[model samples]
Target: MTRSCVVSVGLLLLAVSTLTYGQGLLVVTDPDQVVRLPRPILIWPPDRPVVRPEPPAAYKIKQLEVNARLLDQVAQVQVSQSFTNTGSRQLEVAFLFPLPYDGAIDSMTLLVDGKEYPARLLKSDEARKLYEQIVRKNQDPALLEWMGTGLFKTSVFPVPAGETRTVSLRYSQLCRQHDGLTDFLFPLSTAKYTSHAVDEVSFRVTIESAQEIKNVYSPSHSVEIKRPDDNHATVTYKTKNEVPTEDFRLFYDVGKGKVGTRVLSYRPDEDDEGYFLLLAGPKIESKDNEHQKKTVMFVVDRSGSMTGEKIEQARGALKFVLNNLREGNLFNIVAYDSEVESFRPELQKFNEETRKAALGFVEGIYAGGSTNINAALRTALAQLQDSKRPSYVLFLTDGLPTVGETKEMQIVDNAKEANDVRARIFAFGVGYDVNSRLLDKLAREGFGQSQYVRPNEDIEDSVSRLYRRIESPVMTDVTIEFAFDEKHEELGKPVSRVYPKGSFDLFAGEQLVVVGRYKKAGPVKVTVRGSVAGEEQKLDFPAKLARHSEDETAGFIEKLWAVRRIGEILDELDLKGKNEELIEELVKLSTRHGILTPYTSFLADEDTSIRDTASNLRRADRRLSALAEPSGAGGF
Candidate 1:
């Protein structure tokens, strides 16, 4: 049968949300509270899978910057773009952009060459989600997936063929969470949740046009906004003026280290790693043994999903990791399909000859049959049990638990229980096909780490990054213990992490910031402790926690806060059902905070959504890990 389909609006919202990245609660009682600008958007999936013979991306990566505070459940991104005009003759330009479900669209304007043109959101999501969601009228799942393809929001501007016209955009947004990376999206604001916080959100903008014509200039818009020209603009928003708490002294949240930037290739950035992991999440540290011997179980999935170059890459990566194994380290291999096969019935003794022989077996391995992940896990556990050495299971796969009695949740519980046995599990996800959440849980329970490798990208870089973390434990088992000095600032829930900020996908430099108010000051210090292998280490760092730091770190702090708010909004959308007003507010906040929210692209009137794009992407990605269909394949 032909696959299920839907239009996408949330995707377009990615572009539109940036408009209000610097404004606040200026509730518009009237329609023209601000000019209704034309909607702008990209027609391609930004994270589409990379096939062999890599071709140029259809929608060029004009500019992409995304900073997320996973604990905060909020994400902010800036996308700069340019489009080519292939018209035969001078033709008018128009655009149709979709808003995200939990976001809003504002600061809509069009610029040709350098001249500014008025734009408007003339469409709505009236019909799109009627098919994808239950409450069609009240909610717009289109906002979650919509990317306006046929719709044009720009004032019809004439341009010549074989020419390139430059169009520039500046906007902001706030969004909620969604379920399943596939078409299945869960809103976090399902029960009863609400938040009102905004922070400094900005990114430098530039554009190139193929069809050149018309003058350019930046027209004044909202907030502390300024536009130097159509191709460039800057906006900044104030963070929460009054923090919520009054118990302890609250400070802006930054990755648990000095706020700074650096150029590096071998390490993971505190920012890139996400605040949740370094903060409330489990601490990571690898073991080393100059004397004590340990066993490692390499769990490989030779299912059909691992077919093609992807499998080859996995095999190569696996081999590369295997090569690093030191002498006296016992190891075993579990290759699973519909059933299970072992590298040897039991853990193999580590030595030069055996290692080489195992590598040979890995090279000869081929992909076929269905998936049996649980059985593989069980067998690997058995090998570790049968051997009397500290064991580490490197579980790798690209699909869901398709062929086993062990349910996904059960697998998670069992993995956690297995950890108590002193065996650690390090999980690696390949592309969008693997169950990331499950992998995340497995790693946490096993006291290990989870790393994801996207296709066509540099797998070596990803693998190397994980290796660095394993080797170094700047701080481990880190639990932030800070007493409020005076409860001056209601320091919102903070995400603590210590590492280089560059790791954050957010290209702009990372500065730690707090989202609360200040009342008093006192000595502040954070204590972190964890195991580096089987041994324990501890550190206490003197910190300058503050109610407010108007400088750079505040931006980083608030971005982190916004992520939390977005999570709540997504909860509302996915669980409680649609509440446009709440979503709109979130969209407005995300817009101001430089975060991506669904409200920006989701339209309540049109069924238009980017689901098609992501869905098509899902189908195209035969390697995707998602199983329950409607959304084929998985994610990238």
Candidate 2:
């Protein structure tokens, strides 16, 4: 208990420092004015909407190629593109890329109009997650996708006539701190025409960004050299000797307040990490697209660890999902501590009475025993599989799995085997004590997603989201069939990358981009099969196949999944028996991509405790830097 207060104080102090530094940086740039560019749009063919979103319909893609290489931990992306002005009007094209919390421009080489320009890096805006969330809660998802966000920005490209405009952008970055999780958010500062998805390659991370930027993890080496003007020479490292994982965000703005947004997931064809770009002043709104045969089972971990607001918050979330349950939709409730209890082991039809009853059950839930996530999942799954509808298993927990299947891997394998077309498990890792990796893997393997619920987070918001995903299934039986023959196929390819999506991972947000190479020009068909309600439906999609070289095949999709999976793999280094080559290569790719991998964990945050009195001696240097010094006093 005593240790808790100290840790909380430290987190508070760290958060304050980050906000201070963030504000200080934003203070330098005027919010109302700055050089702005808008993101280029994609021209997607007309087709029935898949469970995922359609790619941007503005940028007519010509030819895009990406190359990736890695150094220790930093990953670099080298993008080559050919874009044509497919429309009549003069178009300004830009690419908006997400930036991690702590990152900087290592180097930028741009070829614009046959002239090269080196970009000066500056953090133009900083915002609290609080404000972002509030706006998101009220904003339209489509507007956010097309407009702009806090970190989202656009690159400038002015094209007229039907001529093909070729652009080469080389951006590299180093990082300072590390956060366990980072959703790179690229904000749009202006508006412009749509562009193409050229190539995006990644390498490895040399350092982390969080360490240099905010620092809640540990101390990192940072270099700052003031130049002639406001620009400064910057290089930050999570360790003494290592490159840094710094992200580059590109933005294109429609100067007169016309901007666009794209809220999507990485490797949209598959379920990768979520990626989004926001450009407008409007807010984002949550949605729940009702689907057929939906059942939501909330398995709550009411352990003593969740005594105060946590329990109350959980109750609110429980009530929210229950209230949202549509008529005739099936649902159940389960609360567990050391033992497990379900409101109904079988699916119960949703009605006014049923919702009231479920709320009563939630009210009766009180913190009691040790966390038994295994039992909770099993019980919830059993309840979820009751009906053939797309059943959602929402598990919330704050402690390690005990009682049943304590081993995280064991639980994951069991849950993976347990998942059927009817059931998808969504895990919520609540508080610091929960084994997030275990829950995360469970959700991934079970066809849902994982989310972290900090102690301060409201349970109502999270659970309501679960209910929404439980209902929306834009297009089911999502399957991808590569028309290419055996040569181009990897040793083992994923048969299909389909899953039920929710509000944050919205169906309309994720872009379904299926990429594969074929040997011959013969046509191929992709057959998909899934149930809309309880009835099975299948569709065959035909498209022309092109042969892409192995080199070309390893582009954005390759690097995006690699960077994402490599981060997960690094987190489980203790498992052992993994390929050293893949790890090493992944490290290099991450470095080039400005992505943090296992080798780059140190760059996320600083570990210094601001609340510890014993660390009073450590404040000497920070104190000096905190106060604004007179310009003439420092050897001027």
Candidate 3:
């Protein structure tokens, strides 16, 4: 028997995009929206799997179910979907899933004809090449983006003329926090991209926290919430036969204090080293602890390039910050281009009269001259010499240094020296042309973080969102230490790097998640230390290390650790030009677990396959290790 097959590359894209990070089953969408597996037209005998030639009039999504659990800030999600075959022919197909940014797919299962099949993970380059070949042969622009992103692949055979096949995927990621809230997003807009209306879509999320849960809200979808107690809540959403144009998004805040400490760990094998994630923060203090007063300074860059909407947005953001300053808090604004100007001669207390005057001052600023980033930072830092108060400098810039201290590194170093008062420098890069390395280095040196906004995003929104998190400082100069005994010393340092990568101030209603490695696993105690209102405070949390490799609760720890670690590598690459060692490490980590970083994507070029590159690297690494070892006869 002979048979011919032609699969729809569009349908394959629907499958891939559905795996985006979040807690729920992603419905498949149109081909143009996401990169997808190549459609292969095959001619073979009847026994082999074959694609159908005719396109279905309507490709309807039958069902979607999402189950998610949060252990502190880490989310573990399971997604299950039923994609029906409406056409009247026995067809063979493979459903593909693209990994969400900074997320790792742990496992996948496919069910067909009452049997289950496991899925496979492919290297980015290998996957990209496969899709590219299909795109070239079939002229499918839809598969282009799939080139570098890691993916999960599963196959189903013999659809039997009107049957449905199910795919289930389990994955996890570290939820990002802004201000006091953690945001969770699920890609659920695929139904709108499909040919037909989705029959049903549903989502359920179970939140568990040691602290009291507050303000569980969804901005993207209307949801019903059920709270059995302060520490637990369940949220659900469902709809029938409708188009979904937006992804599902939810935000929730957990109260601070004793309830804020949590431990999440993962180990794939007992023989292998394990990884751990720790989150700790202080609760809202009473009058006795007294929240510390904060001093905030905004350094705005109104260079010639920001003459249009960019400068207006920056001014709007400054106004928003002034209006929201806490009472008794000290604040100031500095607008600079070729020359620097200040709202007041010095920082002033936040009050109605000053805020009103500040708003007026912001409106008078206009974009002109060249960018003087060095002097701008110096002027802002000059007023923040008070060590007793927690100070923050929100530096906003849209272009590179053009007027004074034109060198990027010199400006970063100067900024570091001027920040002697320990003001956290949260940098905002408004456009693509700004030097990202300078911003990143500045933030790292000043004990803060850097954020980037594209041309389409609103700078005001980004600035306002960041202000909320730092609005109410409860703890400052936070440090974490793990209790190690004589028995634990043999295992070496258990922690390699904590996410955020340095000491930070902890605000009220906020939690910190730290990732690290351990040489050995056993019972352990962790301590969090910080200063509140210029007084030292300490808290301890009890956590027992997972003894074996199959600790279900900690399965996602390793992936989250890799995400942060890869981020560090990227930072280094940005700061100190690219290197072979860094690129090799990035490619290896990405291929092993599908972490999609810009470096990994760049390394996955058309000239060579990522998997082959990784394999060659491993062989070379082994050879180097062997050469470095000392011979018994020659060793002293």
Q: Over the stretch 1-636, how does candidate 3's per-residue lDDT look in tens digits?
A: 000010111124132222211112233333233332211111122233334434432234677778888755667888877777565654444445544335655545555555544432333354455445634453211111223223434433434457777666667777766445677766555433343456777889998866678879988898999999998889999998776656677778865335446676776666656778886654646353365688999999987889999999999899889888878889999999999999998999999999999999999989999999999998899888787678999999987888888876677778878877888999898865766557767887789877767566699999997887687677888888787566666666555566766578886556676788775677777878888777888887677667565435565677788776776676666557879898878766654444445432211112232243333221223423422322100000
TM-score per candidate, in order?
Answer: 0.47, 0.46, 0.64
- Leading candidate by lDDT: 3
RMSD of candidate 3 to the truth, in angstroms, is 11.5
Query: Global CA lDDT of candidate 3, please?
Result: 0.64
Model 2 spans > 4 angstroms off: 1-291, 402-404, 420-422, 484-510, 513-529, 533-555, 564-636
lDDT of 1 by residue, 1-636 (tens): 000011111111112111111111111121112222122111222333434432211211122222212122223222223344332544333233333322323223233455433221211232222323533233212222222211223222233445444333333232221110101111111011112221222223222211121232222212243435432323332223221111111011223322221111111122121221122222232334323355667788889988888778767766776787677677888888898988778777777898888899888779998888777887788656632345567788877788875465578666655554557677877764666556755665565656555454455455544433333333323333444334533653333322221111110121122223122333344444543444555555544434333333223444444544565465445445789897766644444443334333322212223343233221212322222243321221
lDDT of 3 at 13: 17
Worst 10 residues of 3 by lDDT: 1-10
**Which candidate do you rate higher for TM-score, 2 or 3?**
3
Looking at model 2, which ten-residue stretch has the lowest summed lDDT?
Answer: 4-13
Instruction: Evaluate all candidate structures by whole-model CA lDDT and list the values in order.
Output: 0.40, 0.41, 0.64
